[model samples]
Target: MTNNMKNVFDSSNTYGMAKTFVLISLYALLIAIGMHKGVKIFLYIAGISGALLLTYEWFKMDRPSIPTFFIAPLLFLIYVLISPGTFLIDARLAGRFACALFAGVALQFFFSNATYKVLLSQCAALLTTLFLGVTYACIWAPEMFDDRLILSYRNPHQLAVAGAFSIFTLFTYLSIFSKKKQLLVYCLFVIIGTAIFMTVSRSTSLGLLCAFAAYILFYRSKHLIKIVVAAGLLGLIAFSILPATQQQRLIDPFTAPLNDRTIKQRVGIWYTALQGFDEAPILGHGLRAYSDYDSDYKEAHRAEMVDKNILIIDSRWAHPHSLYLGSLFGWGIVGTLLLIGAFIPAFRHSSGRIKTFLFLMTFFSLGYGLTELRIKSDDGAFILFFPLGLAYGSILFEHLSQKNKTTSEYPIQTKPCITKILTLLN
Candidate 1:
């Protein structure tokens, strides 16, 4: 390829950087617009447009090594086709998932040794920390200042998913940009960590704690203890400052009964899920189909009638609480396996530290999925895959670059276990 044509997809050129900027902008816009139907429609359009442009740029240069990259979407597609009469078959929902999968596939094609090297280096960490600090303020300050735009922490699932994304973004920054100034970024991370706590998402809280431990153990920050302390103090202050209703939700016991209901009433959803699993133990009812049955369970158990309009809310929010349950309920064993398979690549090229981080995320995802359907959330989608992709790209690029080096002056040792494992996975 001529230098001019090559520059369009050049690893060192501005094209990738510009695309990243556009992608980030679009993400911020989508989040800012929130979850209204109109906003979701616009988001699907924007997501597809970006994916198309990135795809064009990618195939014009490199091709993906594996076609099994289609596994995730294929599972989702099967669920949609087979789901029962009342399934919430929203085209926008399918579009969002498809768009996310495309983005990841396109990323692999575009990710190069040079890009991976830059992402893994210390400078990347500084940039990430800076971005987190700014976004943290952007999300928090609006809530702090304006009464009309009162931060809706009503949706714990969304809060947890958003918090997970923020935590991943912050860690990615720290991992890539480890410098003296980057230490200051950890302080900012503590602040972002505090905001996560304020969201009061039990799953998110757990995920944030897991991420914190990973950062401390792997990144080895000397000031980790102080950072932890600051996080606790901030959590206390945030709780102390919120309105009484919000505070109750924040401090309520996990087992507390909702709406002053009976134990059966409170646990009705779980019981129904268990029963449903028995009916179709292997394949289950398909994604989002659980709530079609949930409506009947609620009507039977509910003393007072729930709004008919709100009945479909759970359908929009379907996915059994446990990731294991969700897997079984949504796609049966086959679907669950495909979902798990999506993450196996994270284990192939990464080091012990990165693997631990990825596994912790998977663990948290399993825990979070047990009670919430996070896969539908935009924030959750981004959180689940981006770090894995970045780390994988970083390690793979590093390995490829070292192989290309022709000098005896410097040689890098490849981990034997990693080498053998990646060979098999590939």
Candidate 2:
């Protein structure tokens, strides 16, 4: 994993820098593995590494940006702290969120200055790695693509979301920032795009579409027709390649009985979660409280509904499948608003390729969250925070770059408050 990140980051000690880069890269790659259990190990590694780095930096001369974006995580913590019962009550859920949050915040400082390019480059490489894994899985065990390219994910939705995000990253950078490698980037885009379509995750697929459409509208609406036509053709070709039975499975989600497949089952799940929201409309019961609520109360209700044949007996998975609804249950209206704090300002003062990438992620998350509890789960949380940190880091680094440019143009007026403070201390 670290070798994949070689030459992307550097430091005074070339050997140590390479080692650190490898460690960080490998940790990120581990999280990107798409499996539920495997992602956790890297979570601790990243969170702990960030913690130690920040602790040491607290006393060192070299300092990182203030991370104004970190207020989002801070607010989340505060909201969790004042929730109904004791902190220990929601320790399991709360602890996971805390570690993920720390890992994200720490990342904002990890690749400092203009090293964000390295991070984005690393993302493209990681995506390539993931796609290669899927390719191998498909050829070695074709069954992996039976329902959807399950890849290493517990389900297709996870793979779908990750691949979609990777597409957004690759496209944003290659198109807007580094247009030098057009053909190669387009090929990579097609490969990952194929993987996303194969996932058969309708919500994630639509989320990617909506995000891409939005990107066009915001920037290149004039060529919308061409883009749409090309995309439609591509989709048709991808679908045509699917086996007849697999195509039926893809269509069943839309036409099948509500309980038997996915869509209707989702409707039932959403209805149950909304019921819980009604019970506590202000501050939610607590983090991960939905599981117990569903088991004790909603489950019995669903079972009764199932017996009456009014609804299907689709009570397999857990969580309310919607980030908006998840927030409504876990944090309530006010807490949900606070949670948004963690995301909204990430694009503050950003523009061009960076802005597009962040916007893609932001809109994608909202769309994906509609039918998936992306914010609560480990894979979802890790994937989201890592990119978010990149977005925020880009913003901070850009700000610094512009400031330096401005300062260089006018070097006499003021050195910088830092220089003034240092002079005083000296």
Which prediction has the highest lDDT against the true structure? 2
Model 2 ranges with Cα > 4 A deviation: 1-37, 55-70, 85-95, 98-146, 175-180, 252-260, 299-316, 395-426
Worst 10-residue lDDT window for candidate 2 reads 406-415
- Listed per model in order, the count of residue pairs whose N, CA or C atoms clash below 3 Å is 13, 1
Residue 405, candidate 2: Cα error in Å is: 13
What TM-score would you give candidate 2 relative to the actual structure?
0.76
- Per-candidate local distance difference test: 0.49, 0.62
TM-score of each prediction: 0.60, 0.76
Instruction: Tell me the lDDT of model 1 at 383.
Output: 46
Write down the RMSD of all candidates, one decimal each: 10.1, 8.6
Candidate 1, residue 291: the lDDT equals 68
Model 1 lowest lDDT segment of ten: 405-414
Model 1 spans > 4 angstroms off? 1-94, 108-160, 175-180, 210-266, 298-322, 350-361, 385-426
